[model samples]
Target chain A: MAFLTADDIALLNEPQLAHVATIEADGTPHVTPVWVDTDGEHVIFNTAKGRVKHRNLERNPVVAISVSDRANDYRTLWIKGTVEMTTEGADEHIDRMAKKYLDKDTYPFRKPGEERVIVKVTPTQRLSQG
Target chain B: MAFLTADDIALLNEPQLAHVATIEADGTPHVTPVWVDTDGEHVIFNTAKGRVKHRNLERNPVVAISVSDRANDYRTLWIKGTVEMTTEGADEHIDRMAKKYLDKDTYPFRKPGEERVIVKVTPTQRLSQG
Candidate 1:
């Protein structure tokens, strides 16, 4: 497996958005933007259970994430990885993400009765460009 | 097939980068950041021949592209489409893109003996969010 560099970790720590790609059942690609995080090893993102991405990842753990610096488009990272998802601590994780991305105490868009899932991706390949 | 709204065309006119996803032969997803454009109908991007994305597209025309406003991440566009690639006018297209993206009269990174290809996406599905 590939590992994220210090620069990659630093990039993830920023509040930039990640464009995540997952394979649909028919093998078509589905991509959407998400707030991203990292634990210095795994790339992390949160989504609601039963969401399109959540469903896609449940069936196919393989994922591709593209992140570019908000201020510098040339500074970019592409990660191909397999995800391990769980509901544990997903609420807290979104709260942290909200704080990072929105300076809010909690995710304001959270829906009532919605279950959150944290997707932790172990990088099989990491590509960086500046 | 879904059509690009005026707002989508306006977004494409901006110098924002697009995160493009294509399926690998193994059915895994590959995504990268690319300079984007639109003709008010189709989403267009240029890449060199023999690249992984180029080869992937040649084999599998299915593609996904995500573009977000550089100033506002929430203003995003997701497109699922099939691409038509051609070398015709690709050189001129890259120059135009360079002018749009870099304010250059021509693409400065052109390599000797390298041929460029223009990949135009006919959107089958378009998703927008703000």
Candidate 2:
């Protein structure tokens, strides 16, 4: 497994959006933006249980994420990884993500009856450019 | 096939970077940032021969692209498409992309012995959010 570099950790600590790609049942790709974080070992993001990405990852764990420096597009972190998802601590995780991305004490867009899931991606391949 | 909306076209016209995902032979995803464009009917981008993206697209046309407004991360476009690659006009195309992205008359990163390829993606699905 590939390990996150100091630069990668620094980028993840910034308030930047990450574009995540997952494979559909038909072998096509699905991608969307998400608030991103890193535990210094795995890349983490939060999603609702019924989201397209959650469904896709449930079937196929393989995923790719691209995060670029908002100020410098050339500085980017591209990670190909497999995800381990859980509901454990997902509520607090989203609140932490909200603090980073929205500067809110809690996620402002939480839907009623929605079940939050935290996805931890263990990088198998990591590439960066600047 | 899905068509680009005026908003999608406008987003493409901006100097935003796009994260493109292609499937590797191992069924894993590879993603990176690229200079993005559109020809009204298709999403377009440029790359050189022997690049991982070029090789991946040559093997599997299925692709996904995500482009978020630099100023507002919430404004984003996510597209799943099939690519049609060509060497024809690729040189001129990169120059145009250079003009849009780098404000240069020509692509300044051209390398000796590198063959540029133009990739046009016919979107099968387009999703947007703000």
Candidate 3:
């Protein structure tokens, strides 16, 4: 039975850092923590173009995301989504999205050798249980 | 084309904390970082009885676990498995399992209000991509 309701989706729309899981060509899962912003309709996050996550998404876009309260047993939101990548000057967009998860003024805006990419995910499924 | 072979599993079996994903009643996924020992044949971890993760398992046994190198783009391991809970003086077993993930000399051994449960998961599927 489906457990998530529209209200639950709204509840999860807030800004937060979520753990993103990606499937590798070998069927093994690759996971990493990322800063994200939910627009109620989609998930947005950013990373470098040469990263494993970027490579995995290009190979296959299926992914699962989990967002939980840092403290134990408070609340959690899980999102099953597809990867959407853009190539035109995406670094600026990615940097902006990343800043939301950090202290704006002090966050490392970018590192010299690091190239960034912007990714938007449209969730195909969502699960939340508290 | 499996990304992980027996050797990779063996490499991951060494004591480590993995992020475990559980399905919540609301269909939202709950994820928590946990101390785990991979037995090659099975994955074992522990948690308190009334915890959300424990409760989630009682409702549904399906789970996915992700183990990754803290450093960027190194390696990742994913295990899809079912839950196995044991009730007998499981606290002792849990304490022992948890200790393996920590420095024995200074780990928090026990707390009065806490109740521990032992969980054994035999992975049905694994995915690793770096």
**Candidate that would win on TM-score:** 1
What tens-digit string does per-residue lDDT give for candidate 3 at B41-113? 6777777777778998898886678765443223556767777988765666665654565546333656688
lDDT of candidate 2?
Answer: 0.87
Q: List clash counts for every candidate, in order.
A: 0, 0, 8
lDDT per residue, candidate 1, A1-130, as tens digits?
3399889999999999999999988889989999999998999999998888888899999999999898997777898999999999999999999999999998999888999999999999865421
* Deviation of model 2 at A31, angstroms: 1.3
After superposition, the stretches of candidate 1 with alpha carbons farther than 4 Å from their true spots are A128-130, B128-130
lDDT string for model 2 (A9-128, tens) is: 999999988989888788877778888999999999999997889988999998899998999977778888889999999999999999998899999999999899999999987754
Q: How far is candidate 1 from the true structure (C-alpha RMSD, Å)?
A: 1.9
Candidates in descending DockQ order: 1, 2, 3
lDDT of 3 by residue, A1-130 (tens): 4344565455455444467777555544456667676555777677777777898789887667776544332356676777788866566666555455453633365668876777778777654321
Better structure of 1 and 3 per lDDT: 1
lDDT, candidate 1, residue B69?
97
CA RMSD for every model? 1.9, 2.0, 8.4
Better of 1 and 3 by TM-score: 1
- Please state the interface RMSD for every predicted structure, separated by commas: 2.8, 2.8, 5.8
DockQ of each: 0.59, 0.55, 0.13
Query: For candidate 1, what is the total of clashing residue pairs?
Result: 0
- Which portions of model 2 show Cα errors greater than 4 Å? A128-130, B128-130
